[model samples]
Target: MFDFVRRHNRILQFILLLLIVPSFVVFGIQGYNKYSEGRNHVARVDGQDISQSDWDAAHRNQVERMRAQMPGVDVKMFDTPEIRQRVLEDLVRERVVFAAARDLHLSPTEERLDRLFKTDPQFAGLRNPDGSVRKELLAAQGMNSALFAQRLSQDLAMRQVLSAIGLSAFAPESVARAAVDAFYQRREIRVQRFDAREQLGRVQVGDADLQAYYDDPRNAARFQAPESVTMEYLVLDLPAVERGISVPEDDLRKYYGENASRYEQPQERRASHILVKAEAGGPADARARAKARAEALLAEVKKNPAGFADLARKNSDDPGSAAKGGDLDWFSRGAMVKSFEEAVFALKKGEISGVVESDFGYHVIQLTDVRGGERRGFESVRAEIEAEVRKSLAQKRFAETAEQFTNLVEQEDSLKPVAERLHLTLRRVEGFTRGFQPKEAKAEDAAVLASPKLAELVFQSETLAGKHNSQATEIGASQMVAVHVSAHQPARKQALADVREAVKAAVTQARAAQAARTEGEARLAQWKARAPDAASLPAAVTLSRARSQDLPKALVDAVLKAPAEKLPAWVGVDLGGDGYAVVMIEKVLPADVADTGPIDKVRQQYAAMWAGAESEAYLAALRKRYKVEITGKAKAAEEPAGAASK
Candidate 1:
């Protein structure tokens, strides 16, 4: 039986076993690295040793992920020393985070593990009704329930630890409110551009200067074109197999019979409450005393005909609705705390409950109403049931039809004959770019373009349209199409006329920049003559001033690039689109400004920020203390195939 299962699909069997094994480490930075002799130690966070084997394996995984994103990326692209170092840094950080999480005692719950294993889309159709892990899929993913649970638990624990650390640091309300208001108030600006057409006509470019400017490599960069291509193609329509399959009444009835419980919803109730909180400037045993007083008040209210509202207003500690006589608008079960919910459920309509203690405080609840939780009558939900039944039938039939189509395409090597036999029309399209949108293309065509594989195939120069190729790929549910390329037009550089305005703008900007540079240098020389030293420099055509808070972005850019001692030196900057400016720094300030704002708010934001940095430093110190050693040689030996793939 084991051999038979393995023979069914080795890849899936291995995955199932792997899932049973443990959660694989997922760290950024991966590549292929071969040790000429023995494993080398990479880095030590505190004393934790990073092994070369683990680093190499993790790096290989990163390369695989990148290839999956852009399949044509060369393996050599990730072979640089910088790339390897980056991968090492990422691995070190991950180890630190993992070690810290373990120290903090964070863990994933059984419920969360179950959610992770079952809620995956791959297992959507595999689960049993009671929510137990599916046996077949568990075997397929190479994961038993226990192994999956363990791995899931660890991953979740790590996430919880990170979340706790991240949420510990929060921007102040002043910052949050400012960010929120900015987010809300942000508008797409549509600037009415001031045309330079009249002024540009008055300007003349000397032929010699124009030719010299055009010859400059920097000026020529703007005219460079991206490589493009067009391709001919044939698409097989395997998805249409579902359309060809028939849904019988017996199949629908069988599905409905087996899954009857899914069509039902459990019953629930609604109630309201008046709460007298325990600790509102009360005695030492405030909660107990409040509950006792609430009990007495509950009895009094029940006895009084119209005094329930008056009593609630006088005694309820809930400030939100105390003015409305402690009225808690309607709420369903699970909406209230456990103790309060239990009390509310136990009561009948118009019945008053005894004092109940909940996390909030002492509560006196009055049952308001109850509603049916059972499935609605069949007549009211007939249409819905029919749709559900139809979907089930469709899925079952589609599976069989898909298998047939797969066999047909694999054996026949053509979709034309199949389309003819099925009495379906074959469509042809004119020459189109891989990402092009044609007027004749439908929504489904857009979906095809959206697929990475289909898009790749469309752009692949090797894929010829007219000859037999792979069958039509399924882009979605309930839709199938087979297409043949009627013509092909290889991508070409666009005409200069198509980008004339852009070229003109680029040329104008170049001229403006040259003018700004010439003018700035002349002004700087005049200022330098008067000052003799940078310290003596004063307000002049070349001098511009900026404060810490109001530093002009152009000025900041120039200062950042200049020598530290030359900070206040005037520098010229191009602000794009033919704009330019000369700027200088007036002052420099430390990041921490004690009197800038409210001390309390500043303290709150800064403490959290500093704490995270402290935590990171602390973890690094701990790794150094523990002397964690990663066996690089052992890691490489474990996944040689992955390295080879990279």
Candidate 2:
């Protein structure tokens, strides 16, 4: 075959090309086109497009990290339009900063990286006793040591772009002091309040007034009832699955025996060591010097055994334990460097070990104490074993059962059938309007009801029209809910006759507030024309932003904003529904400057605010420089009524 191919090399090459080119044309080109068609670009930074798939993957990673950090929190809270938008913004910001850093040639140095790992508190968990990066910790975050180092270097470079602006921010002391004084300035004032409720009996409303108030266009939404539905929902979750599972006695005992080591408490050793620090990868001469130091400490300890702790406290190089006589409190087998652990475990209590070398350095170890290393009896851990076995079985079965549940929900018209099949209770919620939150719902039920997706599905036109079951929706990890609308009522305006009492009450309150304001204004004009008797005014009280004296915010604002160039200036304040107030300004007092602590705090706060503003402005400039653009619409997540704006 070789001889034949060699003789016809050109012919063979032509044949190969004929076969390869056609395959590439048929699959490679078409497949590439299909893939490109599906990749919808949601954003772009520095002319590099970020597709929808990329945004989705980033959002998923972010949600998973949050879920890991707070397992008990509702997943729906993290998987929202607003949170997704934030993720996209973060992605764009990261790209923009990276571009800026790259253009500015802001790469971090090796020494800087080393110092950051050793000194930064945030990286403490990711460092070893030898002051080296922990590969295992990096692995847990799905990165190798090299990749982690690269990412850290990139992050440091990016931070320099913003840190230059943020860290350099300074607030002039004089300006800060003036602003703080104005913010907390005190005013002594006399207030005469006209309570609206006092005028309610005097202001009368008839049927005509009530009807007119109810028919007003401005008050339409106030009287209109929201569309609501009576829904029956079936929840399939890990807990529900676990509840239905039963672990046999024999299985429980088998599991306990198979995993007996898990029930055993590993032995712990309390040891003290005087360490002579030396990096494993350092010069050989340095390692030898460290060994000599350890040997010298060992000799001193052996000569005066009772004075070992005093010697350790004086000579130990380990900062964490040096002050405490070099005591490394009780730790398990895998907690220390292998060589150090071996030396400590070999020594008897109160015995000292010869100089032992490890990655960190040389150590003179003294075994202090030993404890634990006991296996719990079977009977004592039987209940725990059974619970574990049941949970494991339930978790394994959840995916399969979830598939069946989803199918059953789609096939059936009601949730009852699926609920019975899955051994789940068919729960009903009456008058469940869109965005309705049950005040006293169980945690699980509240999580299900809180899902915006489930609410959207429930109120769909088809689901409402046919009163059928909605498709199963995954509201959380291993949690699915299928809802059925048993009955629904579309939104409609309430009749005037039906809401007569409510309208009457509203009309009376409005008229009463107006009457109170009118009377208060008249009193203010009279008082301003001529100085009223001090006895006629209410008791004088000091008011400031810090101390409102339990007065309404509007009233306090009016008093403080009144011109104080002339003493005893009068100001009229409209308190709306509360009523009105006539304020007589007696005096203005500046904020106390004697306390340096508060003044320093105000200065620091002003600096931080300035830094934040500067950082935001810098980031905006970087975004413009990079030509970052968000192509997709990203709406803010819906907030509940009375929720503070983001």
Candidate 3:
């Protein structure tokens, strides 16, 4: 409990602040802090205050990471309240975890930090050509050697704490084996259902009954339609703009000529060589021996330059291309190391180059075939260019048309007049509630449903009273809508006759559920009172073997979630219609039969759970360790209670 409280301390603070302060006070604080403090601080864990800087940085980092992952995310995507809340919660969680780590007094050693830094793929992949870590990458992630070391230490410490608690609390073999067996075991059910569709034809209603049913307050609600609007509007299309603009053939030709390289494939060569490194150190005699071996290989390559490919496979330090007869597959200029690229590009066709020195040591090169490249002709790509030109024209035309529509709507003061003049079609919609779809509107009818402004206008009382012109809304680039209220009908109650069957069925379900609960409870109570009377166990309560987790998913969930120490708790839940269940946890068999397999598996599962728990506790402990305060508007700025609970 304490740990949980600690983990959610920031949330708790916000909740308390909201519950204690007035809304206007909260608003005032927010306004004052917005200008004075610059950014309204949400909360502080331990001594480290969580400022707007922290929030913004966290949010930006999250968005950037998401952008990296999705590649096509737009700025508008981040504008939603849901996204904002998520970002805020993540920032809060980070502070909580950091605070907890501080409270634990757990730190990683220098050696561990060094190992992490050197081995982490992200850091390792950012190394310079000479095999040194990049300064910029480290700086971007907000880490120096010391901060990175601390991060590693915190990670290690948290893992240690979690493992200690979770691993030590492993379930017994009897517990795990039973759980696994019960879960993996399957049962087939033969089911039959009397569906409403099948009975609907049999459910007949006379004229008088139907009219009576429709008059019923409860039944009448079914006929209540969502608010709707009818609209007439103009649309501008992108294709129209594209058609009006033109790019000359001369210009296209000039573009192709100036950028000829873009159309030409680079020339590539396949070559291979034996690498003998001078960097391999040894005793004086060993060094001399290696040098002599390299010299002998050099002499052999010189003797038969064509044999270089065969020699490379037999002896080359470059494992990347050692197979396939040491063939370094076709590579363009700048594809190879500077030394290698220069050497290979300089060699004449079919000529073997002298030994070349590079980071990989010395390499004798074979000049393989250099396939000359070619530039593509314009005729082959003319169609593609033409299509591009056409699309561009269309887009431009669409924008102009849209602007003209907007101007017409602004001047004429009514969408109906403009639409009629332009010979555009007028559409009428019905059966729409406040949020319901208009009768004739489809999801793709962006002109009607997509505009936020039009949606508001359609719903306004003045518009319903027929005072204002229809609303003009933009759903797509070239699609616009004008919506006006046609008819208004407020919600009404359904008559009892209209919903008589439904009411009867509902009442029957409630009665049946009550009956089941009453019977189940009585039976359960009787069994509890008659201790050790195995024969007295209700015959209706069938005997079955079930692991702790093997009970009905819903049943197990309800049982485990309760205060288990105070077990023998009874719970009743409605199971559709009048069906209901009342469950009684008869007993809890003690855990027995400890074994490594079960313990290890259970330990792994619990490790994750315990770590989260401990992290939470550690955070609370930190608050006590360091007096932290969040005051005024910042406190009220938190998400709603229960909003971030999940």
lDDT of 1 by residue, 436-535 (tens): 5556566765565445455444433323343444455564454433334334444344455565666555666556655555555565566445434534
Ranking the candidates on lDDT from highest down gives 2, 1, 3
Error of 1 at 539 (Å): 8.7
By lDDT, the best candidate is: 2
Which regions of candidate 3 fall more than 4 Å away from where they truly are? 1-223, 230-248, 278-302, 333-335, 370-372, 387-402, 412-454, 457-572, 575-578, 588-646
Error of 3 at 236 (Å): 4.9
The residue-level lDDT of candidate 2 at 533 comes to: 88
| Candidate 3 backbone overlaps, count | 27
Residue 190 Cα positional deviation in candidate 3, in Å, after optimal superposition: 22
Per-residue alpha-carbon lDDT of model 2 for 1-646, expressed as tens digits? 4554455444323322222221221112123234324456898877766677767766776765566556686776786778888888887777677678889999899899889879977665557799997665444334576655666676677778899998998888898888778877889899999999999989988888887888889998878877787878888998899999998888888888888899998999999989899998999999999899889889989999888789888998888998999899999999988899899989899999999998888899999999998999989998888788888999999999999998999999888888888899999998877677889899878878877767777777667765568888787789988888878777779888778888888899999999999999999999899979887888999888888899999998888887899988999999998789899998899875543247678889888988999999989998998899899656655543212210
TM-scores of the candidates in the order shown: 0.48, 0.63, 0.49
Q: How many backbone clashes does every candidate have?
A: 24, 0, 27
Point out where model 2 deviates above 4 Å: 1-58, 231-409, 414-430, 435-457, 472-483, 593-596, 620-631, 636-646
Runs of candidate 1 with Cα error greater than 4 angstroms are: 1-58, 61-201, 205-328, 337-368, 372-374, 379-383, 386-447, 450-452, 470-486, 494-505, 515-646
Q: Once model 3 is optimally superposed onto the true structure by TM-score, how far is the C-alpha of residue 300 displaced, in angstroms?
A: 4.1
